[model samples]
Target: MEHIKIGDEAPDFDLPGDGGTRVSLSAHRGKIVVLFFYPKDDTSGCTVEAIDFTALKPDFDAAGAVLVGLSPDGVKSHDKFKKKHALAVDLASDEDKTTLERYGVWVEKSMYGRKYMGVERTTLLIDRDGRIARIWNKVKVPGHAAEVLAAANDIG
Candidate 1:
């Protein structure tokens, strides 16, 4: 798979989302799209990131941007995680890891000398034309939503 870069057209994907809906990147054309890929549902960093995005959903909407959180977990797991956190952002499930791999977020990671395949924390800001405007790799959750929002506002 080719690695995405700034100004490149973002890869389009349609996947199962929370509330039994499907989210397709192409459906959000003519608006900025925020795609945040996390390792797992209900995990520490991921939860904080989701909640932060949820809190800022109004601001993002005002900025004319769409937010989509994605993980390798299934739709049921996404539903549970969203409900458990009272999250407002859309959470998409990439059960087969195809989308994750396409975005180049799935990789071999190591913890305590144990290595395994997992989603790397990542966030992409796509412009109205579906081109990548910015990318945050190995993301640190703190204040990340605000940063992305700032970037979105800047681009707009």
Candidate 2:
């Protein structure tokens, strides 16, 4: 799949979210969208990233941006993770990884010399016009959400 670049229109995605809501990228067209694709729910890095984003969600909302985190876990898993962490950001379940592939986050990964397919940690900030404003790949956990929020504030 061709990797989506800055200024490219973000590929639309529709997936089941926590609380039984259907999240669609098109639904957030008029607002800045923060689409973060992570490997899984309730994992260490994923948990920290989600918590950080949730802590800054009100600021993102104030900047007219909606933060959505995506993973291959199902909605039930997402709900449990959210509840466990009291996460404030939205979490979308992408069991098939179609949207992850579209965003170029699904890739081959190796840990302990074992290789497998997984979602690479990535974040895309989309402008109000639905264009990609910024892309972060192989994301580090700390200070990442704040950086993205700053970019979103500038773009939105």
- lDDT (0 to 1) per candidate: 0.94, 0.92
> What TM-score, computed on C-alpha atoms, does each candidate reach?
0.98, 0.97
Q: In candidate 2, what are the lDDT values of residues 1-156, reduced to their tens digit?
A: 668889999989889999999999999989999999999898999999999999999899899999899999999999999999999888898898888888888899999999999999999899999999888989999999999989988876
lDDT of 1 at 60: 96
lDDT of each residue in 1-156, candidate 1, tens digit only: 568899999999999898999999999999999999999998898999999999999999999999999999999999999989999998899999999999999999999999999999999999999999999999999989999999999988
Q: What range of 10 consecutive residues in model 1 has the weakest lDDT sum?
A: 1-10
**In model 2, where is the ten-residue run with the lowest total lDDT?**
96-105
> Per model, how many backbone clashes are there?
0, 0
Q: Give the TM-score of candidate 1.
A: 0.98
With a 3 Å backbone cut-off (N, CA, C), the pairs that clash in candidate 1 are none
